[model samples]
Target: MKKTFKVVVDCDDVLFDCNGYAVTKLNREKEYAYKKEDITAWGELGCGLDERLIYFRDPVFVRDMPVLPKAREFIQALSRRAEIFIATSVAAECAGERVSSIIRNFPEINPENILIGTRKDMLKADMLLDDCPDHIRSAEVTYPVLFRQPWNLSVSGVISTTTYREFLTLVDMVQKPEPEMDPMSPVVLVGPSGAGKNRVATALEETGRYRRVMGYTTNAGSRAFYRCVSWEQFHYKRNDFVETSSYMGEMYGTCREDVESVFREGRIPLLVMDINGAVNMRLEYGARIIFVSAGKEECIRDILSRGLPLEETIRRISSIDGEMKNETLCDMTVSGTGFRVSSLEKTP
Candidate 1:
């Protein structure tokens, strides 16, 4: 009978947002419209990889890539059903960063399970899930699971999965899968200021099932924003943050340790982030997103009532429409109609 006694997973396109980020950065920095799908073969990026290689060599650059969408959820579930191992190759310069990223993002995995070298032929596992066809073919595993990518689309005659969720299906089809774990997916409450997302986060935290992750910002508004540290602190421990994004010229981010702490407590980590940050975190961490909105007029009324500088107030109000446009990407939309204007002094 087939069984997933042990499974090896690849890092790049299979887990980390490597190629896509490289493509975006390459396009924006070099002004080239190279689509990721156009990379139909290995080394198709060819000379284009020169810059990406340089960046990948930097530990910060290596660690900053968001986890692939649904990757966290998939791994979390998969690890419970089988012995999971992370096997991939990275530049020697930033290999440690890759290992740290994997362990930090996926605590279910033991550090000993991370394999640095790309010698798939050396690994012993029941199945190998990798985006590279060569690696799949080389693996010593009983089943080589080709994680479909544009570069490997032409690769045939191997077991493959087109989506992250399908990998679990493949496991079930091969073996009688174990009951799945009820993973506590992190939740992000996102909206423009005055949308009462913070209020929702607070409510969730008060329920004891959720822990609100404190964010750090280097703006005068930190005093007005609840559970936010000074941006100076963020600067001091910048590497601790998984990602950082700007909101109205002020920087904000959540540190990895805070989220890990929530996980340790067996509680969901509730977070507040801007639209872009929320979207990235959702994809990177498989976090559920809740878009909180109270309508433009109500949002403006609440912002004005904050009595912040007129310029800052206008900036937040102007960005409301853009933020609202992203509601569709969120898993749930919550009505932030009650601003609780009384608490406006400390929360936005």
Candidate 2:
């Protein structure tokens, strides 16, 4: 049987040859020959200030451009197995043009699923296919793939494919005869206090396929999942951490060495943090964000069992509402109850 996953794709270079189309149009008008390789950067495309806006902002230019080779065919094939979304970043001027074109050309995509926004990081899906390195790196999805283009060929540390057919085969997520994994990215877990995130992380470690990363912290009272440090020591070694945060006036952070050592040992790094910490780490790790939740009532009940002081318990409880809102933004959400290795194994 084949595996399925949600995929959000970009418009400019992934699905349609927007840049290439502009190049062709410019060359035709100027009677100059410019190949795709010549466009290593937007500035190199030889468009002046006014010209760039006129070309990319025009509805006709967007709607009539030829689709990238095999993009339509592979997308149609993928629709049979996945929940496909067209998440394109465009100006409001031509947003409708992009949407109308997709609706007319790809009937497999629901019109309601076409998303127009520049904040691609806010879009939740298992995978995201985009040509921009900034967009790919910011995505908190399980599989943030770079759709290779002449400009993005040199970008490193992300999974990439050169063609639509190759992308289709690459995201065949699990249980296939030759399924593969990209060990470059870490699997990050986030939840509110008393959400049983620690329990879930421990379960992943017991599988022996993952190593729970030990974060460094200045929380003097903390004894688990962290190596406590003095404030002076933390300030001295501040550069060593990839991300840091404060909770109830206690500082915590994940060290670079902790995550890299797990990679060198051939085990995936598992991190349990708050939402902000997880998103901050994605700048370099491309980490897959999973929001582990046990619901508000259950979380409060669990916190009370810990026998914490009244003020501290109240502080944690107040943050529950804000933490719950992040569930929909993460790549995946799993109940803390009975969550096991299989939950992590189900995706790419």
Which tens-of-lDDT digit does each residue in 228-282 have in candidate 2? 9998988788899887665555667888998999999988899998755665555
Pairs clashing within candidate 2 = none
Q: Give the TM-score of candidate 2.
A: 0.49
Q: Lowest-lDDT window of 10 residues in candidate 2?
A: 172-181
Model 2 Cα shift for residue 79 (angstroms): 0.5
Tens digits of per-residue lDDT for model 1, 298-345: 888899998888877777777676567556546657777653323311
Q: What is the TM-score of each predicted model, taking all chains together?
A: 0.49, 0.49
Off by over 4 Å in 1: 1-4, 44-50, 177-348
